[model samples]
Every structure is written in C-alpha cells, then in structure tokens.
Target chain A: MPSSSSVPFDYSADGFAVRDDVTSIHRVSWEKIARAGSHWTGPQRVEIARQARAARAARNDPPWSRDALPGAEGRLPETAVEAARTIGADAHRIDRAWAESMIEALGDAAYVELGSIVVTVSALDAFGEALGRGHEPLPDAIEDGTPDGARLDAATDIGAYIPMADPFPGPNVGRALSLVPEANTLFFSNVMAMYGGPSGSFFDLKWDGPLSRPQAELLAARVSALNECFY
Target chain B: MPAGEQIVGFGEAVVRGSEDLPAAREALRQALGEAGFLEACGIAGIFNGLVRNADFSGIPLDDAALHSSEDFRDKLGLNDFSGAKNSDLSRADASQAGEGLFPHKGQ
Candidate 1:
C-alpha cells in the first residue's frame, strides 16, 4: 500500500470543485467549534474537547471525517455540516484502539498541551499573517517561547502535526493555511495537511516507532475521517 | 466542555450522541458529510481538553472575572502556579459533590 498518502484519494479538484477540501474541512470544523461553545474559555474549554473526542469514538463511521458530528437531529450530514446544520458532526477516524492509545499517551495533561498548541498555533498564525502583510508581530500573538516548551517538543517528535500561526515567520513557520476563498484557492488544504501532511508535525504524537510517510498521513487521515470533516 | 455537568451533558448529547440518535445521526452525515459526526465529536473533545486544561488549575474567580488572566501572576513571570491552601476534606464525596469540580479549592 502507498503511504497514508497513497490511500484517501477522494475529494479531488473536479470531484469536489476545489483543491483544499481538507483545509475547508478544518476551517469549518473550527467555525463549528467556535459556535458550538461560544461561551466557553479556559479550563472548561478542555473538557469540551474531551467530550467531542469520546463522542467521536461512540459514533464510529466508515471514512472518518474528524470534523463531522451528529447534529441535534442525529444522523450524519449529506453535505457539509457547518453550512446547513450548525450542530451537525460526523464520524470518527481511527479504530477504537488508536483512540485508546492516544488517550493513554496523552490524558488531561494532553489537554494542557493542546491548549498551549491551539493558542500558540493561532498566535503564530496571526503573527504570520501580520508578517505576511509586512508588519512587526503584535504582543497579543507571540510564540513566547512558551509555545516551544518541552510539551511541544515531545508532541512534535511523535508526528501529531499541530502547527500554529506564529507571530513572525521563521524557519519553523511556513505558509499558514486559511479557508478564506480570497487567500487559498485550495479549500480543504488544511484538512489535507491534517489528514495526510508531508510537512513536519504541527503537534507532537506521544507514540513513536518506525512510521512511513503513508503511515503518518494515514494516521492523520484516520483522525480527519473520524472527525467526519466535510468541507 | 462547559463547567457545569448539565451543560456538559447537553453538549455531549448534541456532539456525541443526539436528541434522536437515528435521525440525528443520519442528518449529521448528510449535512456535515462523513466527517461531520467525527469532527463534531473531535471538536467536542478538543474543546473539552482546551477548556479543562486552561481552567483545570482554576484561576481565582476574581481574577477570572477581570478582563485580564495572565497565565502567571504579575509578580512571577511564569505560567506555573502554586496553590495557597488545601481543600477542606469535609467536602462531599465523589458521588455527592457530583463528579465535577467544586466551586473553589481542589479541582
């Protein structure tokens, strides 16, 4: 079998009408996430993430979407969950074993690590955008070295792939993704990155062994598929 | 995942399960696509972790109420924290206090 990249050859340009189906899925996922729990911030925020993950396990679908979720109505969506049904979420990506392994590797402590990753990635994104527009990075969105702490390093080594929008473009920060049509012609590029990205990890994977390029992509694909992320 | 168990349950229902499991599940598939359910579940998980970790240690309600919530105190420029007092052991049991964290002290 080809790497994880070898598989998941669906959602092509002509088929989907856009290149970045993956990115679009990610964008929609975030939007739904933001809207799903607008009031939450801080520690409770972490719990919300956990619930989603557990739910994903319970709702196991064939081709995991990672972004998809069953709406208040129940079934998965025929199209994109965000545009039509606000609460609609899809299926999960990996087998129960993978989920269990992930949980085992990173527990609540992973949440803390994820919190930093989310903020760091977002901050880095803002900083990257600002720099892209040619300006000094703002205080509101700096990596603060905190982003590059031990937790992040450990995460990066594992191959979870959790990149953030850094303040200033650097060796670590590459071209960040955005679903805004004006910017990325590829709608689901983010999903693509998340699903089967070749670049180094955005977040670190706790488990480590010998993983081929396809394996990495497949893992990400498993997650995206599980999320039910349709752009 | 919202702090209160009620809200958390509500969220769990919507994201994880659904009000009507069969119909809701189907609709979720059609609307969000295959990843819709999975994504929602993952989102829920992501949010659960994001919120839990951020507030797990619990910021002082007073400080939390304020607009600013610096990771660390003004005095200490570190994100790490140290609790001042121990939780009163007289609190309710796990079943009684409800599995959730208390209003203050010892989450």
Candidate 2:
C-alpha cells in the first residue's frame, strides 16, 4: 500500500474540474482500504477489490462461462472470491437464499464487509470509467494487521439479508452496511462525496449542483434502471 | 432539467459501458458543458455502488418511500425487478401521499 504519507489519488491531470472534496474523500477511502478493517486484513480487502474488478470485467458473460478466479492466492478463501464475484458482477440476482448461504459460510459481519468492498470498488471503477479515466490503480502494498473481528452491538435483524443498525432514522439503503461500521463508513464516504450536495448532505432535496437536482436524479434513475436495482 | 435527455442518454451509456459511450459523452458535454457532464458522470458512478449495496444487503424500501412511490412504481416497471421481492409492497399505505422520503428525519 502507498504509505499513509503517499498521496493515493490525484485527479488534477484528468483535465476535468474534479471537486477537491471528492478527491480528498477518495484518498481517505483508499487509505482506509489499505489498512486493516473490522473483519478483513489489508491484503485480503485489496484482494477482494481486485476480484470485484475482475468480476465486473466479465459482467457480460454467464457465470458458468467466465474464467474461474484463482484459488486462495491471498488470505481470502475461495468462498470469499465467489462472494466478491457475485456481489460485484450480478448483484441484481442476489436473493435471500444466496445471501443466507454466504453469510452462513462467511459469517454475517464478514459477508457485509466483503459486500461493502465489492460495491465500493464498483463505484470507484465506474466513476473513472464514466470520466473516461478507466480505473484508479489498486493500492501498491497491503498494510500489515489482522481482522479485528469487531461488530456493532446495536445491530439487529431487520428482515433483510443480515442484521443492520435498527431504528435508523435514515432510509434502509443508508443503513444497508451498518452491520460493519467500517464498511458503512467506507461506502457512504464515496456516496456523499460523489452525490451529496454542496454541503455534503444527501437529503438536500433542492440540491442544485453544476448539474441541477432534476438532471442528477435523471441520471441516477437511469443508472439504477440499467442495473435493475429495485431499491 | 435542461439537457435532461442527454443526461439520461449519457448515464445509460456509462452504466452499460456501451460502444457508443464516446458519442454519448460528447453529446452530453455539448448540451450540459464540462461541469455538468462531469457531475453527471460522478452521480452515475456512485449509484452503481449504491444500488448494489441495497440489493446485496436485501434492505427493503423504507415504509414512506414504498408508499410515496406507489403511484409510479408499476408505471416505471420497477415492480418487475428482482430486488422488488425484498419489500412487501402490499403493506404500503396507499392513502398516504406526499410523505417526504425521510419521514423520520432526526427523530
């Protein structure tokens, strides 16, 4: 991983007016991913990110026709690789039974963390691709540490795939990764930086960025439709 | 709403990563200017992850959102999505309208 001191991202050369706040948050996210998380180690988290990218690369292929991911190169197990692949490539098809099976094998917290990594990388990759910049490179070195195995005590089964922080005043989508606070934090950082209004508030219904709220929502709705996401 | 059509076209092209993205990107840039085009790209990118997070987590639509959206969910063909199974749409209160999306904000 780039040392904590190294700048992880610099969009200045991209020539487009990338927001400073957006750049800073992405750097922070990369820093966090390079370090150990609540469940997975730095190397394992990076590996999950790589696998997610690989899955996305093969998104057009049927799962059976895609080349198999290598076996257990990093600390991650084969099941972890599959979890990343499914969540990364075919999340629309993910159902309660498949999620339960993954959770049963990987444990709920680990599964949530893995899913968070997959989705976060997906967002980052998509951002670059949209900007015609392709993907930002994965971290060069993995920080050294073990999984903390920590989880929030307040989380409960909310009738979703796994437990989430309950009584959350925000939308269910906002609390989706609450089972693992780090994962939730990691992903939402990108959400806020990328989509939040000038004050970095997602609830700013009247948000008028360079793109008007309607324009932004139009794009968002179209993207969601393309992804086949109901929520 | 100015460039609404181009924004939708650009978003679709980006998300689908289609062969025509270059053409779509140029058209959106011409319609919305550089700042708007870049912002649109950013929004498109993030929603890709946001949608996955919701689907993989199996979280349902919040009650108010589920209800508020009743008028157009079917019209939009959203009900046909696989993730629609996660929410019990039958439980929505159709009588309730204009319930702001975050009905429980701060409380």
Candidate 3:
C-alpha cells in the first residue's frame, strides 16, 4: 500500500474530473485522522475508525448480533467503542438518552470527536464504494502525542445532547460540529468541496455542474433515505 | 425529475452495496455522462456523513424546512424517523415558512 502521505483522492486513473478542492479536503481528513485530536490519541482515533468500519460491514445484521471490536479491550473506552459502532452503522436510531449516557462516560467533547472520526472515515470509504473503489487502507502509522483536551468553552447547550457553538448563521447541520471547531472544519470542508462548490451553490436554485440541481438533490435525498437518516 | 429514476436507483444500489450496483452505475453513467456520474458518487458519499453528523449531534430541523415539509412529512412518513423528535412540529408556522434555508444568516 502507498504511504499515507502519498495516498490521495486521485481519480485520474479512473478517468474522472473530481474537483481539486474535493481531493485535497479528503486527503487532509485522512492525515488528520492519523494524528492526536482534542480528546483522543492518534491510535485511539484510528481504532475508532476501524470499529466503525467493522460495524458498517455488519450493518445488515442486528446490532445485538454484531461482533465486538477490539477497541474496548485495547485502546478505547467501552463507551467510545459503542459510540463508533452505533454512529457508523445505526446513527439514525441514536436517541438523546443513549447519546447522553455515552457522553457521561466519555465526556461530551470526546464523544463528538469520536463521532467526527467515524463519519469522516465512513464518508471517504463510501465515496470509494460508490465508484467501485472499495475501502482505502487505514493509515499504517499513527502520530505519537497526547491529546490537548482543547474544547470550545463558549459552547452552549442548544437542546442537543452536548453543547454547541452559539447559534450560527447557517443550517443546523452546519453548526452540528461547532463544539469541536476542528471537527466542524474537518467534516464540512469536505462537504463544501463535494457539494457546495466555490460559490456555495447549495442554497442556489440553479447549478452549473454537469448534474443539474434536481439531479444532485435526487441522489442526495435517496442516499439520505437509504441510510434511514431523518435529517 | 427527468433523470430522477436513474439517480435514485444508483443511490439505493450503491448505499446498500447491492449486487445491482454494477447495473445501476452503468445506467446512471449512461443517463448522466461521466462527469455527472462522478458528482453523483461524491454526493452519495458525503450524505452518508451528513446524516450521521445531524443525527449524532441531534440538531433539530430548521423551522423553514419543518414548515415547508409539513404537508408531506406525515404522508411520506418522515415524521416517524427518530431525528424528527428533535424538532417540535407544532411550532411550524407560516411565518417560519417565509424564511429561506438559512434563517439565522446575517442576523
């Protein structure tokens, strides 16, 4: 396998013109996952990603029957392990009580960071899957460091399980990761690259892409439903 | 909704990892050339994360979206989804509907 630094979101071999920003954002996400974050160590983050992948692979199976990952026994706390698995395969069913319990054990910031890692890796892998590329190998080496415990102090509870940055001038989804600003940047940067384009056309009724706005929305809505997402 | 059928089929097949994905991908590529096919793939991939972000964070639906979607939310059974509980639909009013997607923007 190519070294993580050499690995990128390259589609040239596949004969597609993926935007430059999209490729860059995806590569950055991979690099970030291999390093220590606000609440989790590098290895912990990577392990969380692995558990998420494992859970998603068993998505067809009932959660009760899904095999336990090595996370709890080795690096991650049991609460974090459960958070990764549930977020990866069954986020649609995640409720406030369950989330609060996990947060109580892992701390709200840690839980949010873990969720971000799971979703980041899942999104990257899903793109590959959509194009028949299968999964990218996880980073072979993790950066060595202790977590900084940096968290958004001003974050306030907005009826969500955890505190979030004060109401922002955007969709609630855009503010979803605000408690961890880096997490918000990590995920939504990819979102903007992949969908919104340079002018932030997500709100625009007309689009100039090869796919029309409706065609794009059709794909987006269908995928959201297939995942059983309510939002 | 011209190419909606093909787009939806491709999305369902890909997300499910179904055996039909190969066939669905080919159909979508034919309908929307190579560029559109790729963009579609990216959209499918990102929404996987988008949904998780929203659900995991427990963000309620924007009021405008809630009010605008009210008519079909129940009929389409969207109100039954777990995340629907985040938003109180009883507060969805016509005044809310007038605001565009980013009601909080510039305020």
What CA root-mean-square deviation does each model show from the true structure? 21.0, 2.7, 2.3
Question: CA shift at A206, candidate 1, in angstroms?
Answer: 34
TM-score of chain B of 1: 0.34
lDDT string for model 1 (B8-64, tens) is 232334333344434543554454454333333333333322222122222222212
State the lDDT of candidate 1 residue by residue for A1-231, as single tens digits: 111232232223212221243334444434332221222222222333333333324333443454444442322122212211111112112222332343354342332333332322222222122112111111121111222112222222111222222231221112121111111212123422332223423333222222333433333333222233210
Q: What residue runs in model 1 are displaced by over 4 Å at the alpha carbon? A: A1-231, B1-11, B14-22, B25-46, B55-107
Which 10 consecutive residues of model 3 chain A have the lowest summed lDDT? A1-10
Residue A172 displacement in candidate 3 (angstroms): 0.4
TM-score of chain A of each: 0.22, 0.92, 0.90
Q: Kindly report which residue stretches of model 2 are placed more than 4 angstroms away from their true locations once superposed.
A: A1-7, A68-74, A204-206
lDDT tens digits by residue: candidate 3, A1-231: 222334566665455577777777887887888888888889888899999988887777898887554445678887788899999999999999999899889988898899898888878888888887677787744768888888888998787777888767777787788888777777877887778543455534336667877788888888988787777
True contacts kept of each: 0.01, 0.87, 0.84
Each candidate: how many clashes? 134, 2, 0
Candidate 3 wrong stretches, greater than 4 Å: A1-6, A14-16, A68-73, A198-206
Model 1 chain A weakest 10-residue run by lDDT: A130-139
Best by lDDT: 2
Error of 1 at A102 (Å): 18
